[model samples]
Target: MAKKMGIVALLLFGVYVLCMYWYIFHSGDGKIPSALQGTAADPVMFMSGKELFLSGEYSKIRNFLFFIATPFEWLIYFLILLMGVSRYFEKITTSQTKWKLLQNAGYLFLLSVFVYIVLFPLNYYRYYLSKSYGISTQTFTSWMKDGVLDFWVSFGMSLIIVTVIYWLMKKSEKRWWLYTWLLTIPFTIFVMFIQPVVIDPLYNDFYPLKNKELETKILSLATQANIPAEHVYEVNMAEKTNALNAYVTGIGSNSRIVLWDTTLNRLTDNEILFIMAHEMGHYVEKHIYFGIAGYLLLTLLGLWLTNKAMRPMIARYGQVLKINKISNIRSYPLFLLLTSILLFASDPVSNYISRYQETRADQYAITLMEDREAAVTAFQKLTISGLSEVNPPLLVKWFRYTHPPMLERIYKVADHEGQKQEIPLKEEQKK
Candidate 1:
């Protein structure tokens, strides 16, 4: 009886997934605008490139598209939310499960409230969004404490970085992006050095990785890479949730690779090493420098264009939007809400830059690393650990996901290694 029920459940899940895939990818009416199409040689990209080259007016051109594209982007987000809610309710079964589901909904609701309480004080870019996603674990009291810490740190750091960047812009108004890029190299190095000690601890507890054998193995890998093994630290990630993540952040005395406790517990030594090697590839490939340079150029251009275009709009609706000026970050949500509606209508171009950067990192990992098998295993583990669907719709993958879907990544690794491996059996299969 149980076996039959499990099979039925699996079949239902697969059917539901297929329906979503068709809805997102194959549905008609072109819900997305042509400007936001993002396919190769998409109209937005072609026009934007032409404008940038012909008129030397990148700032004006990008913002014009951004304004037009925002509404379409919001629709995409609404679709994502609908998918999430649909999936959440899809697994309902008996009355017992229904009771548990109610409890779970209440838990999530309370969590969201607590998160908002904590973040309302700091109330910056991420706070409200975190609550909206119900991912915030901070309590109301904890929010204020965390907000105080965030304000002090962010305030101080922003002053230094913003002042330096502004000074460079004023000094070299015409060549500001190049000068800012030069300044960013050292700024990045400093942030990398200080982040482990200064930034992360303000949010979560960090301790030394406790496993002797695992520590020894990873340290040896670091030695071969000419990086110091002493900075490898374990974060108490389980204290929050069950997500698995690992990353190398910051540089030199302050530089460290953090292995979330969940990642350490879930992945094998070789898989961990592969993940580290992927991060090292970012450094060795100088992606950090390139990313910062691109961002600085984009920001300089965005700021100039935003001022030119948004000033008139903000003046028109400044009172209605409750934003005093185009530059006010406090009115960020409304401004972003307005901007996003425009940008979304032109999705293809906005997402093209992101997709390019992500794929570049994936390519870097394969080209730079030696442990192809381990890389494949790491991706598989990450995919399963995150509960991500092995396959998502192509359009969804192209526009929404930051990293390629887990299965796509795993397949890429397998292709590079030139071998087929047995896929892992699902939970019901083992039963």
Candidate 2:
């Protein structure tokens, strides 16, 4: 039965990949209004013929990789359980040490190494694809260095979280999920609070915006928006990526408005101001707090569901999977497997919420900056830089998009410009 299920899963995955590839690469260009089109001398198209071809091919492969990553991870965990590898780790750790902490550390280290090795090829391919597409500027050595850092950071955090969860399970098997959920609230906040200050610097150098004049303008804009920001910081991203980006991150005093060097070098002051205004909108609207609240709610439900499901599955397949109980250290893979599946299933809901918030931010930016041309052109440049599909397919939009498609954003802002222009003309006619 399990073998048949695995085969079916593979077949479905293969079919989905082929369908998505055709949909992404073969879909025609999005409709652009006649008014929006430029003259033959200076075209205003989002992507030229060559660019469109490259973007489509790039989008298809990246989407396929993303679609398979989670399921592939789940398969690894499933194999570990089915092959009794996890059970073997548990036995070895027990024989080596009676101390629960040390045993867990040993087992998790081994598991982390195994998983890292298995996933490295997929991860490397993602980087290689970006490099080939002219998006990533990072070399193989620098990329490997970052990858190693990522692995260690991930392992350290996972060890802390898993150790606490197992301890809670042993102490209060029935209510461990609730208690773990409660603990996660503070832990998540702590991570967010310190991320900009403590974690981000490890990856790239950040300094006060070198363009002091632009920094003054940004600060003035922040003041007008009633955002209590002191400075704008710029990160050196020219060495790493060609894509442009800016974001607001952290909480309270640690909060930062950061621009990638690429963004500053590529965009005009007005465009950068529009982008900053959009990021400020996220803060003014308190989207971060709302996002945290939403995440906690979903995780609460996910934990409850995981708890309800784990026990019965263990009872039924204890001997076959060699996981006797939820509290058994060997059952860590089972817990992660269930949670991974839940998170994957919830992507659509989460992505929809993100898109809605992003749309609101866009509206706020347009209202604040009142530069429709800048806003429109900024998005166009961003799309070109990232090689983003202007209008992604429905499934990709629903499952993967965290913001509105580029074509949608461009049209909305361009229409806003037209509406503003019409208002003054109507007033003059009334006179």
Candidate 3:
């Protein structure tokens, strides 16, 4: 049975790898078409920037295909974690007590530390690459602090959630997936609410939009757009990265617009207003609800399918984990790892849905803001600020990026003919 389970696990692992590879190499051009407009083009129009490759106009991207294959590297690291967790669970065969829990947690922590060590190089590049391009404000020490803080926060959260999920899974047996998902909705809501209030404060300082002029303008934009927002705030993003960003989150009274300090410092008041208006458009268009609903549906389907497919494998490999009690913390890591692996393996499908939603928000932004040039400039600035590939490979863009490339967004905004404005640099005034 162990031999059979091993063979099946190896086969499944192979399938996972092949699927990831196929997703990267064979996926369609992941950019929207130049001629496309509105929500019609959204949902699957991430085929624009790749028309160059689709037309076979660029061989450069082909040569750099290996660079696009690195998300698979993330997969391998996660699989190692899965194996470690499985090993810990197997060690729990003799006893399932308080001491066992401590042992497993200790092992998981050590494994996590090991993964962090392995991830340090790539993680360094992810940040330094941004800095090398003049996009990051993260000092090395600050980066290390943030990394450790984030990891522990994540680890703690996952520990609790995975424990609960596994407990539910065992308690409900065959109906575990359904019950766990129902529980997850409320869990998700609680997390989302606390995230801005609790989690965000850990990373960035948040203050009410204290500038009356900017505050008034933002309020006015919300009023004009009928976006139903009362709170607007600015986050101290300067502590981390120099890039600009803004977003509206939550619903009704919980809804608020957050501006990165860099964004406020960089964009003109009018441009800022326009950007805020675009964020308001998302709320106005009910994009948040759309996102939430879509997420739930996808999650439901994903859980159902994964549960169905994994049950047999669980029976086969479940013994290797010695997980008699679903509540065992020892089982949490491996299950979470497998769950993440499955989700990561399904990136293409997930990306497809996400790309659609983003395209809708883009259109919503255009219609809401009615300021084409600001949108275009925003895209351009973001691209430059983040060192984004103006035209990335279809597979890379799809499997990796949530937003359409900056060039494509800029082109769309330009094509729409928004009023252009010259933005004065804050630094230039000091000079």
Name the top lDDT candidate. Answer: 2
lDDT of 3 by residue, 346-385 (tens): 6777677666666666777677678766766666565445
How far off is residue 74 in model 1, in Å?
9.8
- Candidate 2 differs from the real structure by a C-alpha RMSD in angstroms, to one decimal, of 5.5
Error of 1 at 369 (Å): 6.6
Model 3 gets an lDDT of: 0.62
**Candidate 2 TM-score versus the reference:** 0.91
Sorted by lDDT (best first), the order is 2, 3, 1
Candidate 2 per-residue lDDT, tens place, 1-431, comes to 55565566568767876765566557653434455444111123444666767877887788778877887888888878877889999898889999988999999988888889999999999999999999999999999999888888888898899999999999998999999999999999999899999889988999999999999998898999899888899999999999999998888789899999999999999999999999999999999889989999999999999999899998987777788888998999989999999998998999999989998999999999998778877887898799887667777888889898886776776654443233222232334
What are the lDDT scores of the predictions, listed in order? 0.52, 0.84, 0.62
**Number of the candidate with higher lDDT, 1 or 3:** 3
TM-scores for candidates 1 onward, in order: 0.55, 0.91, 0.75
The candidate maximizing TM-score is 2
lDDT of 2: 0.84
Worst 10 residues of 3 by lDDT: 38-47
TM-score of 3: 0.75
lDDT by residue (296-371, candidate 1, tens digit) is: 5554555445345555755775544344553232222333344444444334444566456555656665665666
